[model samples]
Target: MSSESSKKRKPKVIRSDGAPAEGKRNRSDTEQEGKYYSEEAEVDLRDPGRDYELYKYTCQELQRLMAEIQDLKSRGGKDMAIEIEERRIQSCVHFMTLKKLNRLAHIRLKKGRDQTHEAKQKVDAYHLQLQNLLYEEGKYYSEEAEVDLRDPGRDYELYKYTCQELQRLMAEIQDLKSRGGKDMAIEIEERRIQSCVHFMTLKKLNRLAHIRLKKGRDQTHEAKQKVDAYHLQLQNLLYEVMHLQKEITKCLEFK
Candidate 1:
């Protein structure tokens, strides 16, 4: 009974390379596969022309194998032979797919290079135009300065313009305050707001000047009107005084 039991037990299967074969692959096969893939990757990176040739060769081989399989099918070829051809076709297809991916990567790399070159050119042109504009602006400011020094009247006009700007900036600030949603103090500290404390002071000074001028004009007009009214009253009073004196003289005669 013990011998029968022992005979019924299955023996461990071993592969020819001496490893247990129960679905276990040989280390050499795995290493060879890895080495092959690594070399292929290296070839793809180092020599694109070689990869292209491989792609072309695979395509031709695939076509020839397909034609041969069709011929064998029509001739009633063995099933094992047909299956072997099919597997070879599958490998060719997979390799061609990798080649196609590499080709697409190359195309995209070239396209990106073109776009970068175009962007660089645009940036250079923009910088050149900016430099020209800066030069013109400096020249204009220098000419204006020369004119200002030659003519002092321009200084007064400039002062007036500055006053106007101050007033306008103040009005804008006041509007912002009235609106009250924005944090004007923080914005000023951050330099996000255009006006500062110095401009606010100028605004106050400008307001005073504007008020003084308006008040003087109003007073002069009122003075002229007052003088005309006083002159009319004096004429009426003199006429009344003369008439009263005449009446008194008549009464004295009667007495």
Candidate 2:
């Protein structure tokens, strides 16, 4: 009956990978130790996926001191070093944030360069196709001319019509060449404008990232000052406790 009740009362357990498992109702001493180790593993912090998540995590670390501070106060204990260490961690958080921003900037810059290269490649491909088309057209004309030279008795009217068609094609080829040059120049200008815009946007992001970093540092500094004040207050309180104990001892002796 006791074993059944214990099993019913056991809560479900979750692993670090977030999988749920059945909790054991009873365990031997070794199994209990293994369970404690598993719990420790499950409690390990996971990697933060985003900058905001990392920032939130750091903020949580700072806020977590409230519980610790309360427990210390209840115990009449002073541990100011934890607050100081937290301040150092906050400073490192800002540095990591800056690195994240720099990494984003590098990624964006690389993307822009890749896009520009792809555009250039596409233009080159189009130019190559145009050149191939012009070559094929010229080959057709040369073949027609060779046929005409080999047979002078062929219809003069047909030969004249072919010449006219050849001239029209040549004019069209010249027009295409001019248009292609203009189109390529426009594409180049557009790419340059895009590059400039990306650069300006990256600069703006960097400025904003730094501004946030400064704000976080200022807040951390303020928190550090507050922590220092609290530490001093705790020290004063401890001194008072010591004085009161000394006075109590003297009174007991006098009695």
Candidate 3:
């Protein structure tokens, strides 16, 4: 009978006040909240491997949410101000990258152009120096040639003058020869006469001889004049020849 009674008795209760079952159930629920929290802590500690997966999922979901927000903004939704600000930041970052790339390209192009310009300047300078050197060489040759030509001209003139003077002297000598022959014949005829004839002949002979002597003297004087003129001409031609030779030597030296 005692064993049957023990089976029918109520078990020991944590909340014995029987106000309403819902109220007691609420109090007991509050009392066990820490235990529920402790059990969750134990599960989280035991599942540390899930942390990386959770982080990855969180990131993917955030990206998806951002994409949805962008779509909503495009469709003219009212809650797109945040999305617009985020897009503006991304656009600024892309714009700055593009600007930096463009600046680097421009700098490279400028450097290439500068190098090309400098190379051209060097080439031009070298060519200009070569041209100036050639011009100077040409001028030197021309000046030397001019100097050489001038000396020969004076020599030619002198030779021509000598020839003319020689011709005139020969003409004078022929005239003197004719006069001397006539005087000699007159003297021979006067030697065979006597008295008044002799006197007249002698007078004619003396006159003829005087005229012959004058002609001979005139011939000698004319010959001497021609010789002196020729000497002067030879001297002038020699001077010119020597000068021309010197100029030719100078030209050779230049070469």
Candidate 4:
């Protein structure tokens, strides 16, 4: 009794490939044509054949239930049988809803995998760039600190695009590290470290140069003031000597 009840209660499971079974007594359809059209709707069903598969399914199940109502005719009145058919149709609708939910879940998973793969590709390309930089002379040291100057208000769009979960980025880096990329990874990291130090040194040197230039200007001004004072004193002494010589000449003439 228990086994029979279980079998009766079991759902008519839709196969993984989207095809229903051959008949009420069987499992899934073997032929490919009976299978669901595709993962994506070609033109959202009405535009083309995209909706054809789902609706075709509904019509098929409706016909099947109507046949079953005919079988139930002698046992129940026409009205009651028709009502039961209506209920069966509702069940088919529920089944299709389940299928849709499954498909939606699959699409989400696929999308996530694709995004992670692309993110990994982006990181790999960046690592390759770092490796290439190893052959060239230091450049970012001379290049302006564009990253440091990033103003959040001025670059709101950029910040929005870049600001994802820090944990996700860390996980990706850790994943890369664990993949036995030790040598290349270390090299790229060392280069980044060097780049940072280089930029800091350049900034410091620029600041020191400005200070030295300002001090040189101040010293030059002070030297100019001293020279002007000396020149004024020399002129005053020459004038006094000339005045004395004139006075002595006058005295001699009087004697």
Candidate 5:
């Protein structure tokens, strides 16, 4: 990324209320900024089938998160815990929003890239194959599902599925291993996770900043109104004092 764009990329410091945490970064601003989701580091669409599965999983995770967030909103509770939960939900939503955009972009960019009917057929076949595998295995989530990419290896189900997929791919495709197949798969997953994290962090911070800024504006407006009220009260008092002095002068003249 250019230095100019880098500077425009402000810090991500979000609180639970979708506001920026004071004097601190949200997430992406801390360490993993500019890792991925850049113009240069576009989404990889070489393996359309794999990308499609990942895209579907990303959508599913987003849906699940949104539902949870809605539920949390509806079931509002007291105090700090609720506040913390809100922040967590806001952050996740921000992250997933970015992920969804990128995944969609990848889908669009890869469109018609595979001109051949055979290539398209294979992609479709792989997609169907994955769906079948999940159904057969009784799994709702995929091996590639990025439920939460912020904490790597926490999505054990996804990691396990990925490892299994890697093993199978290695067995079936001999030439792929020469490119450090399993290791490459792991690396790609990590990078993919980081990319999502990086984007999510950015959006979270932006949203938080906007919320905080709006709050600041509101406070400023309230303060301005208070100042205006005080000024009006002082003017009224001064007017009364002038009237009393005039009456005193009239009384002295009459005497």
Candidate 6:
């Protein structure tokens, strides 16, 4: 019993010593893991002078990148505005050109209408002139026919008076020849001769009347010629007026 107790006690003492060594090994391993973790997670300690220099460099780089982005955005907005303005200007120019063309076409149409109206008025005026001329010509021809109708009756009366005067003259010449044969009847014959001389004077008066009748007939013929010439002149004037009216009518129709 004593020897068995000694063996058990000896194993216990050795186990106790091993326990101390194991505790020491575990403590060293824990320390090494803590050291490694601390080194891996450690924050850099700043040097005051170097810290300020690095901060300034980082701020400059950030400002440069921000300024470049802002410049690109500004340039893009300006380009877009310029393109929009150019399109607007082009549209306005095209609209103005179309408006001017429309105005010109309207003016041309108005001018054509005005010319047509003027031509119509001219034709109307010429037609009125032609009608007036024709009326005047008709009145002149009617007056000339009335004068010609009156002339024949006047010529017959003058011819009958000339024949009566010739018969009286022949009777006077026979009485004078009978008076010359009787000498003793001188006084009676002388009275008969005086009667005969009076008769001859009557015959000479009749001849003078016949000459006046011939002069009147010649004057009437000359008057008729003058009237004919006036009628021809009026007819020519009427022709000219009619021709002008025709030309004006044609122009109006064409318009």
Top-TM-score candidate index: 5
Q: Return whichever of 1 and 2 wins on TM-score.
A: 2
Instruction: Kindly list the per-residue Cα lDDT of model 4 for residues 1-255, writing each as its tens digit.
Output: 999899889678756666444554333434544677755442122221223355566667767766766667757875686677676777677577557645754663464455455545665676558757954755543212443453435444433433333334445544543343334445434433443333444454455455555667888999999999999999999899889999989998995
| Model 5: per-residue Cα lDDT over 48-131, one tens digit each | 355446667666766666677667677777654666577577657757656766765655445323323334455457657878
TM for every model, in the order presented, reads: 0.28, 0.30, 0.26, 0.28, 0.30, 0.29
C-alpha positional error of residue 58 in candidate 3 after TM-score superposition, expressed in Å: 27
For each candidate, what is the lDDT?
0.59, 0.56, 0.54, 0.55, 0.57, 0.54
lDDT of 2 at 216: 72
- Residue pairs in candidate 2 whose N, alpha carbon or C atoms collide under 3 angstroms: none
Comparison by lDDT, 2 against 4, better one: 2
Model 4, runs deviating above 4 Å = 1-186
Tell me the tens digit of each residue's lDDT in model 1 across 1-255: 999999999999855775465787878889888764344244224434444566677777767777766677777746658576776768677676766757655763564355445545665576568668978788433332343244345545755776676577667644543343325434322221233333433454455556555766888999999999999999999999999999999989995
Candidate that beats the other on lDDT, 1 or 6, i.e. the better one: 1
User: Which one wins by TM-score: 1 or 6?
Assistant: 6
User: Lowest summed-lDDT stretch of 10 residues in model 2?
Assistant: 39-48
Worst 10 residues of 4 by lDDT: 42-51
Q: List runs of model 6 lying over 4 Å from the truth.
A: 1-184
lDDT, candidate 6, 1-255, per-residue tens: 999888788443444654655435576878877765321122112222343354455455555545655565567876666555554565555455445444544553464355445544565576567668878888433323344454445545645554565455445434433333233234433444443444444454455556666767999999999999999999999999999999999999995
Candidate 3 clashing pairs, residues 3+ apart or interchain: none
* Clash count for each candidate, listed in order shown: 0, 0, 0, 3, 3, 0
Query: Against the true structure, candidate 2 has what lDDT?
Result: 0.56
Highest-scoring model, lDDT? 1
Deviating ranges (above 4 Å) for candidate 1 = 1-44, 80-111, 114-255
CA deviation > 4 Å runs, candidate 3: 1-70, 139-255
Taking the tens digit of each residue's C-alpha lDDT, what string does model 3 give over 25-101?
67676778745543322322332224334445555655665676668677886567777777656655545544544
